[model samples]
Target chain A: MEFNASLIGQAITFAILVWFTMKFVWPPLTRMMDERAARIADGLAAADRAKQDLANAEKASADRLREAKQQAAELIAQAEKRAAQIVDEAKDQAKVEGDRLVKGAQSEIEQQVQSAREVLRQQVADLAVAGAEKILKQEIDAARHADLLASIKAEL
Target chain B: MAAEQSATDYIVHHLTHAGLVPKTGAIFNFSNMHLDTFWVALALGFLFAGLFGYVARKATSGVPGRLQNFVELIVEMVDTQIKDAFHGKSRVIGPLALTIFVWVFLMNAMDFLPVDLLPAIAQAIGYYGFGHDPHHVYLRVVPTADVNQTFALSLSVLIIIIGFSIKAKGLLGWFKELLTAPFHAEGLGMQIVLGPVNLAFQIIELLAKPISLSLRLFGNMYAGELIFILIALLPWWINWVLGTPWAIFHILVVTLQAFVFMMLTIVYLSMAVEDH
Candidate 1:
């Protein structure tokens, strides 16, 4: 109730407490709080970046997969086309070989026919000459008969 | 009416301070000290400063524990109040407001203890431990109930306010504002005439801040403590009927007084910084 020296005491106490608080308490707490806020913001931004990277990687992998599928499809188509070309080439080769064989056999047959005709013509001429000599009843005029025989062979 | 004299004596005993007694004829003495108020307030101040210091030392930017959250809640609350009220920049104002609010609040909270608990214990120690007369041992636990304590805190605020005014505006500027403020004049002669008037008003205003600040907290806590003492004087069985309600109401009074003291301090400082 009375005004006393305790007032001064309390005032000194108050001042010292305030000084202690200013020096030790307020700055560190506020600094820590601000730092914590910044850290949280950084963490959130990092998370967002990670998510974006994941999406980008997913898109890149999808593109690579699509490209591989296209390449595989192109390779399969080329293989099929190559296989078809090989089959066509084999068929054409077989046909050409058969034609050659047929042609060769035909030529041989034609040659044989020509030789037989010559042999038949020679026999016919010999027979004809013999028959004429028999009819003329002599080996007279053999030189004149040779010229006739040559003309007959030419006609055959 | 049989218990009337004893009732008065009991109330006076509870109201008395455990400190140096003034000389017989002197009504106001500077040598007298309220040791109970001094020790209690000092201890509470240390408790506040110590705990907050501990928290600051271990404070992490990572996830906070419950205790850290609680401390942060209070610190942020005080910070918000300061930021709202104080426009000027000063490092002292924040810590000043925190100390006033927390220290005063702790002081006020001392009123919640049973009115005679500490006194009785002290009396027992004096009687048995020291072989002293128990009747002479007086202890008033709540420091804010003391006018000296509240006045001390508010006067400290007053000093700080003056310091802030001087810092915000230099000494010449502060003095000039004091002499020319709240009433402006066109000519130098007119201004000179109004200067003394303004100075008178300024002194009154300066004195009023501390007077009001100290008295408001002192009155509330003092009245509350008195009421508690009165309630203890009632029959033990029926004490709760009035005690419970008064205690509940006093809780609001205690917190509101502390908050008012802090807010007024910040407002006054802000006002000191601004021109008329």
Candidate 2:
């Protein structure tokens, strides 16, 4: 096909305009946009990684807290058991000491009773001699009191 | 009779642009007017910006919804292309390919609209606002379909390739490449035959890039546009029969043009970034 002058003109015009656009218009704009796009992608990736890390840390902390609570409960149970055992031992020891002390006091009381009876008997003997002297003129009562005390002792 | 003349006139009028014509030898002529080409491109650019910008701005961190995912898929594909084909780090190339792909696609996509849709509206306003004939309205939207647009793109890539060649091979290196490359045979007498072969190869390779780049976009789109116009030319009754399939198939054309342009741009940039 025959080429036209106008077509040639159009072609030249197109070449010039394209050169102008490439040099002046397209370069800076595309550069800035590409940079922005790269930055945005990087920012998004960082955010995702950070979120994952945060979730992992939170789960780890929760697990640690649960484990700590279990340990604390076990320690408390052990302490309570130890305290109850010590209290039971003290109660048993106090009961044994009370029984021993009661037995010793009973033996001491029996010994005191025996000594008081002997003293009372001696006093009765003296009282009988005095009564005999008063009733049957004094010289004969002394000899009768000795016989009366001896007989009273034998009868008791 | 008047209607035919006027119809022809309207097409001729739309065909002519508000740009300066070369007085034959001018390498480049810039048009300050048609603020239309610049503004239209800018507006389309922003429209793209807004649609995609909204997707980016509203993107959820979770699975991307349909619109955002679709856009991201395209962007990733574009990026992977640049990464795969282009050598070295080009902070500028990936997005440049993106812009070219999107801009050209948008330009070509304009053809899909009823060819008369915009001009029809223009004529309506012209009838009242400017007190002109409605049939005289003219407009052409697809910039790449405009040969100047495609050539301009190819030339820019051409300049970039030149720059890369210079940067990679110093002037001395460039000269050495041209004179001594394709050093085919090592035998002492084979040097004579090698010279011509090397020269031809060099010439062929040098001519290949711009021609291929320019023609590839031009051929596909021009053919696609031609098919559309031909289909549109069909009678109303027959249109229904052929139109649906053509239009459905054209969607593939639209998507393919965009993909091809994107891949080629990446390939060219990759070549630019290479040492060879």
Candidate 3:
């Protein structure tokens, strides 16, 4: 318990220990802690970036879906318009064909009627000549009867 | 019991140091080297350094082993304490505090071993190996309980304080502060008159720092050691009944004393570095 010189030895030892610890022990530990903190911060920042990327991708996909829907609608409208145009073209062709057929048939009928009229007129003229001849009970000159026949024909 | 043996002899025998006698008129006689104190203190210091050094060498950025975790916890604790108490930036103070705390705690913890254990072993070695008388063998295992040991630690802190003070304030400024601080007179004549008074007060204040610091730890540990020795004097069975509870209580004292020593050193150094 008495004061003695061993105090110096202890002091020197203490000083050496302090020096050793200051040089070796403390810096590494503090540095490690700082590094850990920095790493954690970096990780958090990366996570935030990933989250933002996910959101941006979601928005881009949504926009593409909306644009595709609009394009599909336009295509459907164009198809419908083309279908209507095809139907109208078919109707016009049918009408034109019907008009042509009707015209042709009318012309043929007119020709047939003409032919029948001609036959009828010929018969009528012959009948008139016969009647005149029977009444007179004599043969009339054929050249002189020509005017009567022509007149009969005109009247018919 | 031997015819010469008494309670006073027993206590004196326990208190004596085993060391070489200081040479007469030696300038370095102020440093009386105690073999027991040096050996115990150095051994414990090495233990602390080795453990911490191993941890430092194997330290990883990933999940740590149990030993690494424990070492890191201690490092963090001491770091936090230094941050809290020390106002100025110091590269040395953190490790210094750690060393002081751990070293002192280890020294003080030596008290928990049965009082006669090491001494008996030492006495046996001296008697059988060296052919020395067993009764002449002296060994005090608890280094911090020795005044010289505690004072050595405190005196080192005192040196740092002075060095820091001088560094913070120039030599002239530090001298002037020692002369005129904590008391000053308005007039030049009055100041001259009060110079010695202020210097005396300053010297006492400076000297008191180490004395109180060392004595506080030395006193507590010494008393604890004495109590253990007294308990040891009792019959073996009765010794357990008293020693167990005392040892448990002394555990707090051991840790607290170490904490006080480290805290005070930091505070003193902080004050030294600060202006005015």
Misplaced by over 4 Å in model 1 are: A97-156, B1-5, B22-27
| lDDT of model 2 at position B147 | 54
lDDT of 1 by residue, B1-276 (tens): 115448888888888898887334355679789999999998999899999999999999899988888888878888999899889888888888888888889999999999989998988998899987776788899999998899999998899889989998999999998999878888999999999999999999999999999999999999999999989988889999999999999899989999999999999999999877
Q: On TM-score, who's better, 1 or 2? A: 1
Candidate of highest DockQ: 1
So what's the TM-score on candidate 2? Answer: 0.72
Per-residue CA lDDT of candidate 3, range B1-276, in tens?
Answer: 123478777776787778677334443455456889999999999999888878877777667789988988888888888888888877888898999999999999999988888998998999999999877888899999988889899989888899989988989999998878778888999888889998999899889999999999999999999998888777776778999999999999999999999999988998888876
Once fitted onto the true fold, the runs of candidate 3 whose alpha carbons sit more than 4 angstroms away are: A52-156, B1-13, B21-32, B234-240
lDDT of 1 by residue, A52-155 (tens): 99999999999999999999999999999999999999999999999999999999999989888888888887777777778886763768667877897688
lDDT of each prediction vs. the true structure?
0.89, 0.64, 0.85
How should the candidates be ordered by TM-score, best one leading?
Answer: 1, 3, 2
Candidate 1 vs candidate 2: the DockQ winner is: 1
Pitting candidate 1 against candidate 3, the one with the higher DockQ is: 1
Lowest-sum lDDT 10-residue window in model 2 chain A: A1-10
- Chain A TM-scores of each predicted structure, in the order given, are 0.69, 0.60, 0.62
